[model samples]
Target: MDSYKLLINLPDTIVFLSPNLKVVDATDEYLKATMKTREELIGQDFLTTFPDNPSELLSHNMMIVRDSLMRVIATKDTDLLATLRYDIPKPESQGGGFEERYWEAVHKPVVDENGNLKYIIQRTSDVTQNVLAKRAAELEENKYRFMMNALPQLIYTTDNTGRATFFNQKWYDYTGTNPDILATNSWQSSIHPEDLPKVIEKVGHSLRNGTEFQMELRVRNGKGIYRWFLTRSIPMRDENNNILMWVGSSVDVHNTREMVFELEQSHEQMVELSEQVQQAYGKAEAERKVLHNLIMKAPVFFCVLRGPEHRYELMNERYQKLFPNRNLIGQSVAEALPEVAEQGFVKVLDEVYETGREFVAEKIKVTLDRYGNGKLEEMTLTFMYQTIYDENSKVTGIMVCGFDVGEQISS
Candidate 1:
């Protein structure tokens, strides 16, 4: 029987180790994974051939591996190491430095029928990508937590079971309660007694139906005064459209509610005054006022560019941050962002104009002068350019809407 032939055909990266921890044989996958040839590895001591990289955080990674191998040999039991950060050194021709890596490894002992240790089978899987992705997610979650805490409004998150998972610092500040108490659902104790049952019933119905949960209820503040708040929750879903958790916010609306009630009570007196004001100003002015307010206050970055040259016609407050000092209202993209023309974004605009087609781009990479310095830096943005048509149904301009999603792209 050809023992080596069987080991060589395995798809996983595997290495056969003698009792003394020498590399007796390895699979082709092992050779390709390690960028090594059979002659360089076959007779070498396993630890010496793949030593712990000096750049690694833990100096004893190799030592820990050796200990695991020894334990398997002594007990004749398989040992699994879930994950370890172990960098690998590149060959001299490849610049000779260690590259960061992660591995899921196992040491399986091969015992003879007489219960004597014959060899150790070491198998390893590269899991660097998974580790990095998990780390990035953690960092992003932490960033969001910080942002939530900074806001004045109370914010909270709950798991699928409707149990509290997280509450921002603002929640504690407003409720005068700590996480330990909130963890036990004590935050609900701050709700107005008369409104509690109604709020809970509404929330229960939303949770059961997987719909948006919203309620206007009076909440007791830190000073023990009940004030009106509009608490709302939305489901956060995964890529598969399955609800993962609930993110909710509690916004104080006590003053606004009081003002609205006062206005309603004085409607008879305001009716005459409102009619006089309407007579003074045409109906078109009122409509324009409403439209202007919507554009100025909308959360998204909104803009419009007219003509084939793509001269900017309008930009909202949020869009103005793209280039703080430079006014883009009448400048073409090429004139306002000369650095972008070289990055091929100007060509993208031209294509959209020529075809009169809406262009949607996500994570589009461009080099721009982020700090007003002549030196350009790369940035990623997700944006859309929709053609605006004239009365004759001809393309006249492009409407733009987008925001900076660089953090998401990098993650």
Candidate 2:
């Protein structure tokens, strides 16, 4: 029986080496792939026959391959190389320099009947395409992760069973919570104690029904302060319509909630002030009607300030429109219009209150953050700060009436 002929007929590129790691025989496929002849490779050391290419970067060094083969010889066990880059020298007829190549090499020991290692069979498979494709895929995945982490919202993903699987870097930064803590659907730990129950119940229902999930709830931030967040999630399903994963995000809505609350409070204060004004018009209906019609329909801003801090007591429709959605009632002048403090308005109010005299300012240029976008705008206003007096001639409060004269000034 010709065992050598049978060994050479196997499919993969194969080479037989002596126990001393010297090439003894090689198949036709091995000679063709390596661009080497039987006469040139025979009796040559395995490492010397395929040496490391010094010019190529990150190429596999033969020393590592040699050590692996030695380990197999010592232990009489097979050694496998998962994947490695090795540049192969081209024949002189072709370019004589090395060509880039990747391979999966396997070395198996050939033991004799007496349990002595006599030869080693080396097999190799070309895996260059697979390795390069995997590297490109990794690069693309890294870019996607970077974009997700750059978002201001807290983004996360969960498996079909509602177990938290992945979270973006913003989640860790905003919550200061380790992902390990929420690995097993324990993400509720970051929610406010009062809101956690509702959040869990609603999320559980969504996972069970595979429906859209949304909630406005308070969550504790890294600073240990609770803030409102609008959380929304959607299911990712396979072609068969089976849920595979859930993608979710939480946006901070603290400022929006504050604005809504302030608007509601302002509405209630305006209704109460209207009732008070109506009750004060018990007698002299003609005079009261004239004052009421002028205050309501006067195209100018009108508001009354009371108390030592000059808290907003009453404001007309035009006055409320000037600072829309700002809960001006029950707020002092410095607290409500903080941007006006340095513009001499507060000083004028103080002088009027102390001397019980009226202070009139014309074409006063004031800087205000009109839209709350962190930008200040200059506005010209003609206003009067007049002191109110009770029947006993005691200063009670200040009445401010103003009109935006920016257009007039420009014209």
Candidate 3:
């Protein structure tokens, strides 16, 4: 077989350039790949035949290719160019436009026996598909990261072995920690010391059994205050049901927890007061004074509705603060808070009074003109309405107690 014919029929896209960078020859594969004939490329200046795409403003294709060829000649050694965007122009029959293309090229110097450069052999492979796929994957990853950072809950991911791999922006903001913590077991340092042991044990159990991990723990904030968080995590599994990773979120529940605790304590106090009032009917005036003092000193809101009309006979400072500068005492529930009445709170109070039973609601949403500004604001509360009784065991009034839990619910 003829050596030149063998080179022309080679499968690899190969081209030969003269010492002056003129295209001397190209394989049949190179001609087909460039959508050109041998007559159009042979003896043509290499740069002139393959110019940079005119539409690409910052195109450095010509400069990059020229530099590599020059380096091969100067060093009398092969030069490699990885992942270069060298678009090819379509033939007139193909509508005459540039087709975006990527390539990896190798320029090997054909040196004389005396070590002088004679010609350069260039080989290239199309890598457009690989480059485009990589870019698409990167864009999807960036979108996922943005969504994670935008969430109100602190989100994180970890390997199946329980090592921390990723954390959203809220986590860093709340804990005041960096990615360096992932290298060590110090990520748990942000957890309250009292809660850390339990967290570790629960996480270890999940890792061993591939079960969901969940717990309510206190986490220290950037300001050094510890707050309660309800955290839950589940394993991401593959087709074979093997755990690949763990995704988790921690929702702040500090406000709701505190409010509930205080509400329980106040409920106990109210129960004691009811017993005292019923037992010491002769000392009613003295017991009323003590009840007034207790209501005033209470941390949560408190109010008393007297008679079947549900008139606000007494209200604590906290209850009054709900509608600042507005008089609630001596007015019926419907009159003082028309919005609350519209939401059927009065009907709830009536049921408690008639049935002689306590009504409890948790994280109930209510719309109120809280500042008396006529602009309605939504709030969440955990509250109770307890029926008050007379010495005759007949229900005469109702006691209202609640705590605003809007912040916790919204979070």
> Please, what is the TM-score per model?
0.58, 0.60, 0.67
**Per-residue lDDT for 169-240 in model 3, tens only?**
999999998878878758888999989999999999999999878788999998999999878898999999
Sliding window of 10 residues with minimal summed lDDT for model 3: 282-291
**Strongest candidate by TM-score:** 3
Best by lDDT: 3
1-411: candidate 1 lDDT, tens digit per residue: 897787797899999899998899999998888878889898899898888876556634987888899899878999998798877767898898777888899999998899899999999998889999999999999999899998666888998867788899988888788899655877678899999899889888878889888778998878998999878788888999888999888777675467446544455344445565656786556545545555655555678989999899988887887667767778998888888887787887888788654466666776778556687777678777767889976789888877677754456
lDDT of 1 at 122: 92
Question: Please, what are the lDDT tens digits per residue for candidate 2 over residues 199-278?
Answer: 88998999889998878899787899889987888899999999999998877767546744665465455545677655
Better of 1 and 2 by lDDT: 2
Let me know the TM-score candidate 2 reaches against the reference structure. Answer: 0.60
Arrange candidates, best lDDT first: 3, 2, 1
Misplaced by over 4 Å in model 1 are 1-3, 72-78, 111-116, 159-164, 180-183, 204-215, 235-245, 255-411
